[model samples]
Target: MATLLFVLHVLGAVVWVGGMAFALLVLRPAAHEALEPPQRLALMDGVFRRFFRILWHVVPIVVLTGWAMWLGWYWGFGASIWHVHLMHLTGLVMAAIFGLVALGPGRAMRAALAAGDRPGAATALDRIRKGVSVNLALGLLTVAVAAWGRFGG
Candidate 1:
């Protein structure tokens, strides 16, 4: 059961963080070079729609499995090492940032694109990019904490 929970937790983080990394690093640059504003915005809209849908489910799984590991497997709260606490803190903050992007700029981008407001969509996408950038950095940091902090200590 613990193994299963750990696997799920890691998978959830991989999907979210990996997806962000690819979208930000690879996809964004390729799309910018290959497409114009209208096409680029449209592509981003579609990509975000699909990604956000997946994340809606993934986020909960990640949170639940993480909690199960910390509270159930690790002997519940305050009993684990500092790395675990850092992971929990960063994970929650990342989740909140995802929520902000999905609810705020995400919706705006969709609405703006639907109404043919390219500039508005661009603005929203820019905001989303910034949020994703921050989250990606945090995700990498959390990953490092989870990986090295265990053995380094």
Candidate 2:
């Protein structure tokens, strides 16, 4: 059971973090270079819609499996190692950022697009871009801490 939970947890993390990396590094730049504002915004709208939909499922799984490992398979929360605590903290931060993107800018973008307000959509997309960038950095830091902190402590 623990092994299965670990696998699910890792998969969830990979999907969420890897998707953010691809959006920030590859898709965003490519769209900016190749597409006009309207097209770019449309593309981003579609991309984020799909990605966030998947995230709705992935985030809960990641959280549940992580807690299962920390509180069930190994030590309870209070007894967890520093790395575990760091990972949990960063993960929650990422989730909070995601929540803001999904609820605030994300909905605004959709509404702006539907109403044919390109500039408003752009502003919302900018907000999402910044949020995703921060989350990506935190995700990478969490991964590093999870890997190296195990040995450091």
Model 2 misplaced stretches (Cα beyond 4 Å): none
lDDT of 1 by residue, 1-153 (tens): 999999999999999999999999999999999999899999999999899999999999999999999998878897888888899999999999999999999999999988989999999999999999999999999999999877896
Error of 1 at 33 (Å): 0.3
RMSD (CA, Å), candidate 1 to true, equals 0.7
Backbone clashes, each candidate: 0, 0
lDDT of 2 at 141: 97
Residue 1's lDDT within candidate 1 is 95
lDDT of 2 at 106: 94
Clashing pairs in 2: none
Best by TM-score: 1
TM-score of 1: 0.98
Candidate 1, poorest ten consecutive residues by summed lDDT:
73-82
**Taking the tens digit of each residue's C-alpha lDDT, what string does model 2 give over 1-153?**
999999999999999999999999999999999999999999999999999999999999998899999998658988887899999999999999998999999999999999999999999999999999999999999989988976876
